[model samples]
Target chain A: MRAGKGLKWVTLLRRVADTQDTDAFAALFEHFAPRVKAFLIKSGADHAMAEECAQDVMVTVWRKAGQFDASRASVATWIFTIARNRRIDMLRRDRRPEPEDLNWGPEEEPDQLDILSLQQESDQLVAAIAELPEKQRVMIERAYFGELSHSEIADETGLPLGTIKSRIRLALERLRHSLS
Target chain B: MITHHLSDKLLMAYSTGTLPEAFNLAVATHIAMCDECRARLASFDAVGGAVLEEVSEPSVTMRADALSATLARVKAQPPVQRKVAVPPKDDVIPAPLRDYLGADGEIRWRSLGGGAKQMVLETSEHATARLLFIPAGTAVPDHTHGGLELTLVLQGAFADEHDRFGRGDVEIADEETHHQPVAEMGEDCICLAVTDAPLKFRGLIPRLAQPFLGI
Candidate 1:
């Protein structure tokens, strides 16, 4: 069923890429737009800004659909990256002096062994996150979802800056170990 | 090969898109040269995907016309023409830096004496980025940071109290770090440095020149 669902998304993306099909886009919008909005809100964007950013992210996904490589990243991962970048762009709108450069360029093709290992690691990510201790999980959530800097997290949590950095570092070490 | 690398926390912040633009530039430039860091970043991106999957759906719903409106906009707009980045023939500068350098493709360096020169890159108000060129075996004045400083070696290597930094390596220094960085003998060291505030130079000459340098 998981494999089937992944294939479905791949097909939908292909349809949008090949034909610029609105129907395919609509399906994607229905599934991802609300999630993107929620993700933005979790990152401290107000509701209005989150809604607008979500709309922009979907538009970008539509325009850049042709550039998506299913072999390199899953559809969900790709869409999540778009949403994250769009939120950052929104925050940087007035402050940034230069145009947003979103091009990551072509990633080097992975060897078969690398691809297999990465796939296995990707599959374990969710479980690894679940296994994190409560304090570590909270730190990760604040850093990733809340979009708080170390200092900001320190301020909010009333923890020393050094403590925040050390805890987050430990959590990342565990995640890296499990993923590797 | 890079002996030093960006900390995992920095890479995680970068992958999650939480870094300010200056830090983002440093990370992107370093990732351009280091394949290992790029692959590690991909894993962090996968973690972001997992975290997104677990975020419970919000109670707020989109406007009823959101999807239709998006489709209409998509139909109205022409397909975007993406400019494929040409890899630089000169290995000295990578593609990410090239995007910022623009047409002239040359840096106008301001000499800082002692065979060191710098060219500042315009960025956001929160941080400053500059390209520093230090001749081989020369030492930068001993100083500590007022805020965070992230430096990526683009050409030769440098050594400080912490460790040796080679091509594609990133050195993150904070207010607590105070050391003089010396370029390794071989080639002039070229680095992309981003800092939130000016350095606190210990020497009278460097301290006097700091204001004029705009670092």
Candidate 2:
């Protein structure tokens, strides 16, 4: 997250980055350190690795606080991005089993069509995706949100894995057209 | 056209950082090549920013020396590098999606147990776009989407309660749609998907392992 003049924390960070204010630095570190650690842990990192990476992320935050852009990215998004990059690097180190490989089942029932529908710019997208029909949404969500593989989605959805894959591909095309 | 599908709602969740790790990885891959999805995600990020601003701020208790310690370290380091910042990508999607989804994309494939292979495709400068590809015959236990479901199939086939779909087919199911699919025949199927929310897992073990599963 970039520090801006108006944002409460951004202002504080800008001051601390400019002047070596131990108190400000500590406050920033203390607030975000654990969250960063937990974020990493949630992304499949071990506790120790998460802690170490969290420290690294915070260190980067310290150095880059002056460059924080409140308009471009939220503090959480910036921190998350840092953590994400770190996790990606860790994942590249070696292959390990990923336990969270299941597929997301289906979209939660839309409470209201108005709320569920996307706005004008996004409306095109929403309409297009909505146009995909129920069957495709089922397969798509199971594979994409549920993180289920075609085979996995098939196993749970009672559909052939190949069928699930084809549906996803077609759904994407329709989305593209709607946006265009 | 790659014909890989990504939903607007899922794009929003992903941009908001609400998606589970597994699905997030897939969306990441599809977004890399699909600019339409990328633009839609940018809008989600904007909405997320507005929403986050409304979220109650977390408690801000902190040690007095935290800032000082952080400052001291930065002061001791070499001059930091600062690159000229560029404006973020647009919110308007491009036309003819294939060009975007077909661009040169690189992803790191990770194998989860039992013949299940996963890869996260990097989509944009923001890393907001992604595509997840899973081969046929892979089995993912029954589960649910975080909020929205979007799927597109490029090759092969899979079946469900409604019917079976081959290449160029699409589906958008909801909480009401719950069923498992096993790949048909010997051919593997490739799908493209995008989602926003994290999956609401079923069963105690899945719920317990949700955190570790990163889905």
TM-scores for every predicted model: 0.79, 0.37
lDDT of each: 0.70, 0.46
| Candidates' RMSD to native | 6.9, 16.0
lDDT (tens digit, per residue) of candidate 1 on A1-180: 134344466668768977888888888888888888888888878989988888888888888886764444556667888877786677663122221232323432223333233334444555667677778666766666745563444323221123223332333333334334
- Categorize the docking of model 1: acceptable
Model 2 clash count equals 93
Off by over 4 Å in 2: A1-6, A16-22, A91-180, B1-6, B9-73, B78-81, B85-215
Residues A1-180 of candidate 2 have per-residue lDDT tens digits of: 322212445445656556745567666676567666555554566776766676677778777665554323345445555554566566542111121111111221112221112222222333344455578644443332223322233323221223222323343344334333
Evaluated against the true structure, the overall lDDT of model 1 is: 0.70
Clash list (residue pairs), candidate 1: none
Candidate 1 residue lDDT tens string, B123-168: 7777788899999999988898999899899899999877999888
Instruction: Give the TM-score (vs. native) of candidate 2.
Output: 0.37
Q: State the iRMSD of every prediction, in order shown.
A: 7.5, 12.9
- Range of the 10 consecutive residues with the lowest summed lDDT in candidate 2 chain A: A95-104
